[model samples]
Target: MNTEVIWTFLSTQGADFALKVLGALAAWVVGRWLIGIVVALIGRALEAGKRVDATLIQYLKSIISVLLTLVLVLAILDIFGVHTTSFAALFAGAGLAIGAAWSGMLGNFAAGVFLQVLRPYKVGDFISAAGVTGTVKELGLFATTIVTPDNVLTVVGNNKVIADTIQNYSAEPYRRVDCVAKVANSVDAQDAIARLRPAIAAIPNVRTTPAPDIEILQFTPEGPLLCVRPYTHTDHYWQVYFDTHKAIVATFGAAGYPVPETPVAHRMVAAG
Candidate 1:
C-alpha cells in the first residue's frame, strides 16, 4: 500500500490493537491474583466451619479455582471484543472435543465427587486403594495424592481408586500387627505361648482389652509357626510389630530355646 495509507492504519488500528494486547495481559495477571484470593478465602471459610472434611475442602478449592479461572479468561476475551455469546458457543464446541479426549479426567472428576459424598476415606487416613498402600495426602478433582510407606509421593486417578477395593486402616480404633515366630519342633508349644503372652503384652501401645494372641499358626519343615499378633492403634502398628519380634527373640533366647532348623535330606548311592 502507499505510505500515507500505511501511516494512517498504523496510527489508528495498530495503536488500538497494542492497547488491547496490553489490557489482556494486565487482566490475566489481576484476574489470576483475584482468583487465588477467592479460592483461599473460600478454603479458610470452609475450614472455619469445622464441619467439612479436609478431603472435601481440598476438592472444593480445586473446583472453585478452575471455574473462576475460566470466568477470568472469558472476561479477558471480552476485552478483545470477542462477544461472550460467541465465546460460549466456541467453548461448548471445544468442551465436547476436549471431553472426548480427556474422558478419563472427567471420569476421575466424577469419582472424586462421589468419594466426597460417600466418605470412604479422608485426608491423613492410611488406606490401601487401587493397589496403592499409603497415607492420603490430598483428594483432588482428578486424582488422589498418596505418600507411601517408603516416602514416595504418588498420584492416582480418582476413578481407579473408587473402582477398586479400599482398605482403610485408620477406619478402626485398632488393628492387628501380624508377626510369626518359629519354635523348634522339640520345644513345648504351650510353654512358648505362655512365655510370649506377657512379653508381647508388655510392648508399648499394645491393646490390653483384646490382649495379644500367640498361637501355633501351622507346622512347617523348620518347626511350628507361631502367629504373634498384637493389637494396637494404626499409628503405632509398625512400632508394635518390630518390638514384638524383638520380644520374641529376647524371651526365646533367655529361655534357651533351640533354633528351629529346616531338616535337609541327604541321599547315599552306595558308591555304585
Candidate 2:
C-alpha cells in the first residue's frame, strides 16, 4: 500500500524467496546438463569396450539417469531452505508406502535385472515376447522397447516379458521362411516342386546347406498346397519370403499352369 511497506517486504521475505526460486531453476538446468553428459560418457565408454552388451549399457544409463535426477531434486529442495536430511528421513519413512504403491514398477525393475543376467534376448534381436513381436530397440530399467515390423514403436513391461515365453528369431544362425503355393488340381505336384526347388535356392541369401524344402503340405478342393520353405538368416527373412512367392508365380505362369480356384458345388433340391 505504501512505499515504505513495499520496500520492507521486497528487502526481506520477497527478495529471499525470489532468489531461492531463481537459484533452484539454475540448479535444475545445470544438473540436467551434467546428467546428460555423464550418461552419454558412460554409454560411449561401455560401447568402446566392444564386449559390453548394448542392452546392458542402455539399462545402466536408465538407472544412472534416475539416480542423478533424484539427487538434483533434493538439491533444488535444499535451495528452497528445505533441509536435505529431513527430506531424506521422510523419504526413508515412506519407503514402504512408495513400494506398495509402485509394486508393478518395482516388479518390472526386478525383471529387467533378471533379463540382463539371463540374456534371453538382446538389443537389435528380433523376438516375440509378451505378445509383442519386433526387433528389440532397447532394454531399459522397467521396460523393453521394441520396433515392430510395421515400424511401430512399442514398449512392454519387463515383468510381462520375463513371465511370458520369448521366441528369439535371431538366436539361430538361420531361420526358416514359410511360404505356401497352390497349384491347379490338374497340375503335377512333383513338377511344381522341381521348378520351385531351384528357383527358391537361387534367391539371394537363401541358405544352400539345408536346402529349400518343397513338399505337398495338404490337399484342398482347388489343388495340392505346397509348403515352400527357404532357410536364410533372420535378417533376410522378408526378402526371401516375398521372393519365394514371386518365384512360385513366375514359375507357374511360365509353365502355363492354370490358376487354382475353389470348386463350388451346386445341388438342386427336389420340390416337395
Candidate 3:
C-alpha cells in the first residue's frame, strides 16, 4: 500500500475511535446520575414506610444503585460494539468459585434475613445465643453485634447464632429470678419461708402481685437448702435478685439463725 493512503485511513479511524470514546463516557456519566436519582427515590419510599430501619434502607439503596450502574455500563459497552458475552461468562465462572469459597458467608447472609423477617431479637435486647450472652447492638447482613454485660463488643456470625438456641431474657415484660439460700437444719423451715417473703417484698423492684415464695429444695447433710423465686420487671430482674439475696442474708443473720455447716464427728466410739 502507498504511505499516503495508509496515513489517510489511520486519521479517519482515529477520529471514529475518539467519537466512540466520548459517547461512552457521556453515557456512563448520565447513567450514573440517573441511577443515583432512582436510588434516592427508592430511599425516600423506604423512609415513608416508617417501619424499616433507616440505616438498613440506606444500605439497600446503595446496593441497588451499584447494580443499576453496572447494568448501564454494560449497556454502554455494548452500544460501542464491545462484546460483553465473554465478560458475562467469565463472571459466571468466577462466581461459582467464589460461591463455593464463601458458602459459610452465604449461610450467614441468609440467616440474617431470616432473623430480620422473623424478628426473633431486636436491638437492646439481652440474648444468649451460640453460647454467648449479650445485649444486641446491631443486626447486619453477615454478623450480629452484641455488647456484653462488661461492655465488651462481640461480633457473632448470624448463621451460628440462628443455628443455636436463643434465650431472650427481655422477651417478656417480666422475669422470674431464682436464688438459693442455705439455713441451719435447726432453723424451722416454715419460719425461714415466712422470713423470706417479708424480706423479699421489702426490696425495691420486687413484684408483690405474683408474690415471692421460698421452698425447701432439699435436706443436705449440712443444712436445709432453700430456693427463692421472685418476679420482677425484666429490667429489674438482676437488681431485685441481688438486693433480695442481701436482704435475706441480713434478716437471717439478725434473727440469730444458725449458719449452715458441714458436720464433723470429733470422735467415734469403737464397739468392743
lDDT of 2 at 76: 93
List of clashing residue pairs for candidate 2: none
Residue-level lDDT tens digits of model 1 in 1-272: 69999899889899898899999999999999988999999999978976566877887899899989989888888988888997788889999999999999899988987776677898899999999999999977678899999999999999999999999999999999999999998899889999999999899999998988899999987689999999999999998988999999999999999998766541133332
Best by lDDT: 2
lDDT of 3 by residue, 1-272 (tens): 59888788778787887788898999988988888889989888877866556667776887898779778878888977989998788878988999999999989988986776577889989899998898999988789999988899999999999999999999988888999888887898889889788888888988887888779988887688999988998788778889978988898988899988766641222221
Order of the predicted models by lDDT, top scorer first: 2, 1, 3
Candidate 2 lDDT, 1-272, residue by residue in tens: 59999888888899788989999999999999999999999999878966556777897899899989999999899887788998788878798789999999999988987787678988999999999999999987699999999999999999999999999999999999999999999999999999888898899999998999899999988899999999999999998899989999999999999999766551122222
- Model 1 CA RMSD to the hidden true structure, in angstroms: 8.3
User: Following a full C-alpha superposition, what root-mean-square deviation does model 2 have from the true structure?
Assistant: 9.7
Those runs of model 3 whose alpha carbons end farther than 4 Å from true positions after fitting are: 1-51, 72-84, 100-110, 263-272
In terms of lDDT, which candidate is stronger, 2 or 3?
2
Worst ten-residue run, lDDT, model 2?
Answer: 263-272
As for lDDT, the candidate ahead, 1 or 3, is: 1
Give the TM-score (vs. native) of candidate 1. 0.67
RMSD of each: 8.3, 9.7, 4.9
